[model samples]
Each structure stands twice: as structure tokens, then as C-alpha cells.
Target: MSSYVEGALVEGERIVHAGRISAWALWHLIGLGIILLPAFGIGLVFLIIAYVRYQSTELAVTTKRVIVKHGFIRRQTVEINLSKVESIQVDQGVLGRMLNFGTLIVAGTGTSHAPLAGIADPMAFRKAFIEAQDEGQEGI
Candidate 1:
């Protein structure tokens, strides 16, 4: 668990699911050979981006809410209460489906939509979230 998510947790809120972007989803390895070139600035930039994204982004679901955190210095975080969530949409291309990585778009009440890309086992994440939501609602 990242410090960001841990610090964001409220009293009695427990994490139900936690996940990170898969390295394979980045596909930066295909361009790794470009680094050998003298003018490899573009390739290096891609590698840096992929590395940063893979390392910094986190997705989690708690008993109270769903949480997503991304970025390094200027961080971006999204938290949506389970009760407010309207839908969790998953998109996977052929490759993504084969590799088990996809994008998850979470739509909450109003105009809020949080899109988490390259997430590993997005289906499982959605399942956990739905289960948590059911459990939370049952308690009410």
C-alpha cells in the first residue's frame, strides 16, 4: 500500500482491493532498443513516462470508498464513496484482454468520472468493489 492511500483512509476504513499498472501494459520495452541510438531522447522520454506511470499510479477500493492516486510531485487523487458510484466500466483491447490489463473508468454521481489506465486485473478490481458495495449497503 502506498503512503498516499494509507494516509487517506478514514477511521475503520479497510482496504478491499489494491492494484498497480502492469509493466506489460506500458509496451515501452518495444522501444527500449532505441535507447542505443545516439539521438535517443524520444525513446528515453517514453521509458521515463512508462516507468513513472507504472511506479506512481495506484488503485484501491476500501470499505468506505474507491481510491486512485497517480503522479509523482504534483499528485492527483480521486476518491468516490461506494454509495455514489454509478458504474465501473472496463475496456480492453485484444492484447489487453490476453495480458489481463485494461482501463477502468469509474463514473460516480454527477459529472465525476475517474479513468484508471493500464490497471492489472481490472475485472477483479471491479468485482471486489461491487462486493464491498454490496456489503456496505447490507449494513445500512
Candidate 2:
């Protein structure tokens, strides 16, 4: 869990599902690094960038809200209450489908959609959100 997500949680909130950027998403950088490693140390920079990107992003469905954060210094965060979430849309390409990683678009009532790219197991994230939403409604 990222510090932002942990800090954003309120009383009684618990994470139901945590999402991550798939290693597959970093293939290009990894490949570039490997290909350039023999030429110079520049390849190390690509690998480091990929590692930083993987570590800096976080996504989760919680009892109260869905949260997503990206970046370490210049941060971007999104939160949508369970009751206000209109939809969770997943977009998968051929490779993504085979690898079980995709993009997630979270739509909240009266709010612009938040698109999270390169998320692993996006369907599971959507399922967790749906279950949480249902449970929250039952408690109301």
C-alpha cells in the first residue's frame, strides 16, 4: 500500500482489493534496457524509471471508496464513494487479455471518469468494487 492510500483512509475503512501495475506493462522498458545494456549504462536509467513507476502507483477498493494514486512527488489521486460510483469499465487488448492486465475506467456519479492504465487483474478490481458497493447498500 502506498502512503497516500493509507493516509487517505478514514475511520472504519478497510481495503477489499488492492490493484497493481502488471510487470507486463513494463516490458518495453525492460526490453530497451536489455538491448542497450551492452552499448552503455544508459539502459540502467530505463530500468530505474520502470521500477519507480511500478512502485509509485497504487489502486484499491475499500469499504467506503475506490482509491487510486500515481506518482511519487507530483502526485495524482482519485477517490469515489461506493454509493456514488456509476461504473467500472475495463479495457483489455489481446496481450492484456492473455496476461490478465488491463486499463480501468472508474465513473462516479456527476464526475468525470478516472482512467487507470496498466492495472493488473482489472476484472478482479471491478468485481471487488461491485461486491463492496452491494454490501454498502445493504448496510444503508
- Indicate which candidate wins on TM-score: 2
State TM-scores per candidate. 0.87, 0.94
Give the clash count for model 1.
0
- Give per-candidate clash totals: 0, 0
Which pairs of residues have clashing backbones in candidate 1? none
- Model 1: lDDT to the true structure: 0.87
List, residue by residue over 23-120, the lDDT tens digit for candidate 1.
87877653662663357466666677777877888888999999999998889989999999999999999999999999999999999999888899
Question: What lDDT does model 2 reach?
Answer: 0.90
| Model 2 residue 14 distance off true place after TM-score fit, in angstroms | 0.7
